[model samples]
Target: MKTISWGIIGCGDVNEIKSGPAFNKINGSVLSAVMRRDKEKAADYARRHQVPSFYGDAQDLINDPGINAVYVATPPGPHEEYTIASLTAGKPVYVEKPMSLDAESCRRMAAAAAQTGTKLTVAHYRRALPMFRKVKTLLNEIGDVSLVTIRFFQPKASALVANSEENWRVDPAISGGGLFHDMAPHHIDLMLYFFGEPLSIHGHSANQAKMNRADDIVMGQLVFPGEVFCTGAWCFNVPKEFASDECEIIGSLGKIVFPFHGNEVSLHTGGEVAVHRFEHPQHIQQPMIAEVVRYFSGEAAENPCPAEAGIKVLTIIDRFTGK
Candidate 1:
């Protein structure tokens, strides 16, 4: 694939701006086609985005001779099916985060890619964000790391607490679990990128809110290869005033603090503190999509966020959720 002519499956909200526009914006990349279960919506998306074609069935998009790569932007439930089909059609793939519904599905997707010799990557786009890169730099400046902690507390009124079947994020049948399954992958993937695979992981989760079948709270600890200790707590039933989203990394010399959802990165060392704030791009996933294009075009050596790395994060989530 010298130039990446892309076809996207499940062009929903995520595709509107986060990724869809990026395909055409990147060098040597084109938004050749798109697929959605709703033909009207798929046609509308294609017309609005200036894509050449649209399809009502995934296989039609996958088999499009004009498309050289596929982006599986659907929900977690069908990721493995669409991804494997795309690979079997001899096209590289860029699937959305959480990789698949479970570890076994992730492994199957990975195996399919291996079998077909097609490149596959997950949209753990945070790995390519400026704010996260700043965090990595601050970690390096903080010297030898000693411990790390992640905390996420949300008010009861947050949309994530919705228990309706319409809210697929909390619907286990489609989403695999709750918002934890949807959101935790970003943070966990970053943790894996910063520190290698965990040597040991112990964690637990519960439905403290009774708002949904999925767990609204989760707590876990991970021991990394260099004796680095890490802990994480996520709760969705906190008071509005008590809500928080932060991560702190303590090193032998000092510590760094930042929020996974915020723009600020703070560093404390030598009795001095500094804060750096990074504003996100309008099309947040464009940078990462550019990297993916580069990899597919053979301009880059490796995919930044590969299926193997994503599977590791899912495995960690499995240990916490007992799935």
Candidate 2:
């Protein structure tokens, strides 16, 4: 099998732990190069991760003949431009979440991938997590799912002001919206994965915490197929006591509670409750990164998370914002 040379674009916080090291860990993938707008910062990340090369410009990495694939870890704003550039250069791309801030850019990305015939994937890491896999398995363990609720509460973005300008995420012109576009994409995608398309969406958002010019908190109500209702909120103002991201699946026979970053879930059935701990996997990004390498080597089917799924999430976000 051919080893895919991977180049990382945007070496920032998300790259430090979430994905940067996965390129080095995958069997058929090599972390050949990384790029950041700041040469010093990029060099720091490269040295820390032991990557072979570092570039101050994305074009430098994209133009490298040794980089068979590129991973865009930057903010959602520049996803379209960088992804299109990589694909046009005949390189596969694995982009971060919320592929773009709007549906139009998402469509353009999907079209470009199709035009170039370059495989495209997104960093929807939850689909590859063990606990979420357990949740997917137990979807039918109880009975038909009736309601799904996901709650993510954290300290308001106002409190932690780091990286406010390093990335374009907080800027409405670049990021589209605040919490709704920035963080809720994962939860929305998971909802679509568990249930089908939502027929109706009714919700509201507010700049309660004054995190930015956009709404700091968003609450959504989605009516999925088969009457499976989902309600969720992205609040950055919650206290430390309630700081967590968890999803609850309520079925006809039981209820399942999955805590993010935790290995187990609480299941209650027929008035009998039990705790189920998942078998921890190697790492969150390992399988997903490996799968991409395998795909690039012609040893697998199409990438699991495609651009269409991302477009759907963007549409849902638009619905919430009346865009």
Candidate 3:
């Protein structure tokens, strides 16, 4: 793992820009290979990305001698399988968010990493992004936090989902739920990062639209250790004009406000308001990928987003969905 040669499994839309190019952009990292069930598509992606090789099977990519680390970018359905295999083969791994199908599967991946003594990191990439990092830093200025509320109302006609011939994001069997399953991980992970683990989680979900296979609305609350509370609502059937995305952190002194997907933060304190704005990176996940490379190359001490943290997120999601 001297130079951190990488192998990627699954070529989803996220890989196209968010992560794939980042491997090559980092100092000690290289995108050595890629894999997809369709060999033609895999080769095409490799060619387009200037990767050295591609494979039709994930196992082949994992076993490739040129690759020292593996990135599992596939849907959650096969995350556990590929992650366990990569670890068993003595390869470090960076698995996508929502870690796996559920908390149990994440635990299995973590157990395999422990038994095999291999490194595994989860792609809660926001944990390393600039805007979100600023949000965490600003939490100190807000004084003792009391309550945080999140509202993400996306119109069904314009849901922000990955493009694909088969829409697995709304397929409960493969994605574990609907658009909420696809997007909630980032916000939920941020809450945990800001406020530690929760003592209890409670919520519910429903397919209010009846036009989709999975739930179109989800609402939940988290009880943080210091009695800090967080409640969120995610709705996909809202009218296009009513669609909104915002998070408000109310505190003893002042409060902070921001959107989960946007790059602006507003702070209110002492009867004054200040705002901060950031430009999105060409590769939004590059910051996290840089850290992951360091971790895999032994320059860093620990996993950036470990499986243990991922399990907590899955737990909250399950509680909210009543799984």
Candidate 4:
């Protein structure tokens, strides 16, 4: 079997254990290098994660011939640049979503991937989660999916007020927007995965909790290919809100409820409900990152999250942002 080595561009929160360890554990894969702007932090991450090399600059790691792919975990603002650079270098990229702040950058990255003949994948990790896969199966089992609803409610601004300005999420330029852009891609992508493209959409967002640049609360309605209706919202500032990621699919036979009890899904059928859940102990990034290794080795048929899928999500996001 061919071996695939990986270099990670941003060795921050997401790479801790879930993703970093998987490179070494997955079949015929290795996490050979890592990079961060801070030299000491990058070196420390490399040491801790058992990566063979570390660099203070991203380009240095990407240029490594031993590295077959690069994972970009930086914030949304710079996703386009690094991802395009990696693809241009003829290395597959598994970038964290939202792929870019807007649609045009997504197009540019996709075009870069096509031009270079390299695999460009987005880390829409929800697709790799086991429980969500079951939901997809249940949907297929029960035909005539008519309505879908996904709700994601996070904390208010003050509630999550950081002592330092280092928390870039509050800045629209860095995060793309408020919770909608930061968090909605996961939910919205699930909508697209379960159903098809949304025919049309109408969206409204407001900074009810007080923030800069964009809305903390956003709600939108999407009409899917079969006239399937999906209503999704990201409400950040309520008197009380839990970290909720939920979806309800109402079908002719029955309805499936993915009540955000951890990352599991529940089914409601025959006037009674049963739980169908599979918890991924690893962080969402690991399996998808590992799969890229498989794709490169010809052990896998396709990228787990293809560039086109990210483009579709960006297309929807563009409609929401009106650009």
Clashing pairs in 1: none
**lDDT of prediction 4:** 0.78
Whole-model lDDT values for every prediction: 0.89, 0.82, 0.92, 0.78
Compare the candidates by lDDT and give the number of the best one: 3
lDDT of 4 by residue, 1-323 (tens): 38878898888865786577778887788889999888899999988877899999988988998888888988789899999899999988888889988878888999999899988878887777777777888886556889888777766653322233266766789877765776678777878787777789887767775656677877788999887998887777655536566778898878888753365666777777777657675555666666677777778887788877888887787776565
Residue 21 lDDT, candidate 3, scale 0-100: 94
Q: What CA RMSD would candidate 2 show?
A: 2.4
TM-score of candidate 1 versus the correct structure, residues matched by position? 0.96
Candidate rank order under lDDT: 3, 1, 2, 4
Model 4 lDDT at residue 59? 87
Off by over 4 Å in 1: 159-165
Candidate 4 global Cα RMSD? 2.4
User: lDDT tens digits, residues 185-286, model 1?
Assistant: 988999998888999999999999899888889998999988999999988888988888889999988999998877898899999999898899878889
Task: Report the alpha-carbon TM-score of model 4 versus the true structure.
Answer: 0.92
Question: What TM-score number comes out for model 3?
Answer: 0.98
Scanning candidate 3 in windows of ten residues, the lowest lDDT window is 157-166
